[model samples]
Target: MLLPGSGSDDRFVRSAFAGPLSAFGITAVTPVPRPGAAVVDGYRAALDAAAAEPGPLVVGGVSLGAHVATAWAVRHCAALGSRLRGVFVALPAWTGPAGAAPAAQAARATAQLVREAGVAGALAQAAAGSPPWLADELGRAWPRYGPGLAPALDAAAVEPAPTADELAGLDVPVGIVALADDPVHPLAVARRWCAALPRAELVISSLAAFGADPELAGRASLLAWLKAGGR
Candidate 1:
């Protein structure tokens, strides 16, 4: 199973993978947090639930969720043994220094703004220069997206982001995919990921390759890699 980025309901990532994953007979479950709850807690609970059922569970996630999944794999590698396959990391936002990710900061700032002005008011400002599709999607999913997110984003921003030096030492294979035009998930980070790991692929996507691309097949490159890698 793969997880969504911080602030994104699991449905977003799950829907993106459901059709493609079915061809390979992979079943996915995206957990949604109860209102006003923390995403991490819900995620941990989800992971625990997943672990309760199977031996060979493959986990992957985007953004903060990606880090969580990766960390889980690393920590449990000895226990999961060969059952734990590889990881698929898509659009990893900055989890490092102050400037690592502006979107995280923007998200936090926007959250505070929303508390004051509400979703509509916040949507107007968030839509200013960002891609229309991204902004609109965020606005549409606002109700389901924001509650568990504020704390997640805050906690994620301080992650000592995986430096090339750090990633080079990871135990399992990792797949990195990025969007060139997207500021949240930077291409440079993906490049560094591919360069650092023993086995890693950096799939660079374009502006058109994301957003309006209906089939979402291009973005599915990560999913294809996941299935191929035995996920």
Candidate 2:
């Protein structure tokens, strides 16, 4: 299963993974989130629901979704054993307490902007500061999330990430893809995850690569998985 970042849906996930993973016969499934729902809890529920589905499953996600996937694995290790094939965590936003992370700070700030200025005005502000492609992406995906986007960002800003010890405890093979220049998803954070996990592979990727090929996220992650010897 593939999970998208905050303000994104299954379409983005599908675009990122479907074509790339298909070559290896991996069918990616991305779920749609209910509007106005709590992001973390909603994704956790989705993860639990996925666990009941038959067949081995590889779980992965981007940004906040990546954090949720790892947190879910830590919370449900017993139930997910063997059935959980591998974990693909891309763009891990934070590592410790929520507010301590740059991404969380940015999320909180963006939430405030959206709340004060509304979506259109917020988009204008974001576009002024962001790369054209990023602004375009947010422009397209943010509206689908509706008014809940801000609150979701706020909730995610404060949501706890798996601790270093918790990360070290994971027994499953893990793959991580980090955009070296994305301060929001710091390469240091990704490196920390790679170092903490007993079994993990880390690949440094770039925004340019994604622009050149949207499927590169999955391709890079799959390579990381193969490097970790995932079947």
Candidate 3:
């Protein structure tokens, strides 16, 4: 199963992961996001439901979605055992507390803008400061949340990702993809995660490459996972 990032929906997730995973005969399932603070809970519930199925499953996502999936894996790895195959993490924003992280701060700032100016105004403000591709993505995805956008952004800003200790305890293979030039999702953070996880590999790419190919991160992550010994 794959999940979307903060303020993103299933459509972006499908575009990012479905095609790459399909090559391995893996069917990617992306659940619609719940609004506001319910976002994390909703994602966890979806994972629980997917776990009920009888096959090995790989869970992953981007940014906030990556954090949630990793936390879920940490919480359930013991019970699930080998039923949980591995994880595909793309652009992990932070580890441990969200405090002062660029991505967290950005999310908080966006939330405030959404509240003060509304989605359209917030999108315009965000687009003005972002690269063309990122701006276009925000334009397409932000309005989908409607009035719940601010609360959802706030939730993601404050929600803590798994700590280094938590990651160390997770023995499952992990494939991580990091954009070397992405300040919002720092390469240092991805390195931290790769170092902490017992079974993990990191693939470094550039924003230019990712912009040219949306599937670049997904394919790199899955290949990294395989390199880390994930079947």
TM-score for each predicted model, relative to the true structure: 0.82, 0.95, 0.97
Model 1: per-residue lDDT, tens digit, 12-130? Answer: 77766666656766666667643343566567677777876766676777776676666566556677777666666777766435364665676567657767766667778778866
Find the candidate with the highest lDDT and give its number: 3
lDDT tens per residue, model 3, 54-117: 9898999999999999999999999999899999999999999999999999899889989999
Residue 209 in model 2: lDDT: 77
lDDT of each: 0.63, 0.83, 0.92
The 10 consecutive residues of candidate 2 with the worst lDDT sum are 33-42
Pairs of residues clashing in candidate 1? none
Error of 1 at 136 (Å): 3.6
Comparing 1 and 3 on lDDT, the stronger one: 3
Model 2 lDDT, full chain set: 0.83
Candidate 3 error regions (>4 Å): none
Number of the predicted model whose TM-score against the real structure is largest = 3
